[model samples]
Target: MSKNYVLSLYNKMGKLPFGKKLFSLFASNKAPYFKTVSPLITKVVPSECHCLIKKRRKVENHIGTVHVIAIANGLEMAMGFMAEASIPTHLRWIPKGMDLQYTAKAGSDIRCVALLENNQWQVGDLPVEVTAYDENDVVVVKGIIHLWVSEKPKK
Candidate 1:
């Protein structure tokens, strides 16, 4: 089974200056559409991934808070990191759907945290929950993401 590129990179460059930004740069190209949402990954580990999305013109809502859609994108980026590193190499997975609640206006740069307990992983479909918080530590968004999981085809 092949190693995950994203995890490989974090292992090699996770401590360097601007390393987190560099990782996100790579992700921007790998998933170009996500670039529009502009996620910046700050940290990652087997159990969790952290990300930030600044409130800027590209992602700001009419009232100047980060948009809910942009917050969703941040959640997705965090989840993608976990999925890339957590799924067994011989298994394949895809997002089936996601349910999110926008609980408050994201008044500052939003911090997103995606998590999956080591014990929750299994061989079939899985649901991973993620949350995004404002600078004040208030949860601005919450999500439950469903993913379809199965064995990889013989090589």
Candidate 2:
């Protein structure tokens, strides 16, 4: 999909609590690969964010291991949600870059636990690293998310 199209969807999503649910349904219906590795934001608080993904055959690569792209997409999903949740209602956030390291093979379900050092998700221009782990608790990917912050109208 085009970046403009995706950003338009995201902007619309920022308006509703159940937006991700509806978006996921639409995405998974049209692109069933999403059904396998789509990450869902389960909970968010001031200090932490939780995301979950299911392992399924559809996301497996040629060797029956999880595709690297799929894992990255899941990581981005979690990071995006946490990035959105961490900032106040008066700010807009966009990812600038990502530094990733794949430490282990992903052969099972995955969960991304994004811990914020403070409630601050934005402080001008800076990058944050969010780590993801597999079901066995092994580090699978570390994403150093670079984000640009701007002010948005208060909700």
Candidate achieving the largest TM-score: 1
lDDT of 1 at 147: 84
Off by over 4 Å in 1: 1-4
Model 1 pairs in collision: none
lDDT of each: 0.84, 0.66
Q: Native-vs-model 2 lDDT?
A: 0.66
Q: Among all windows of ten consecutive residues in candidate 2, which has the lowest summed lDDT? A: 1-10
- For residues 65-94, write the lDDT of model 2, one tens digit per residue: 777777766666655656654566566787
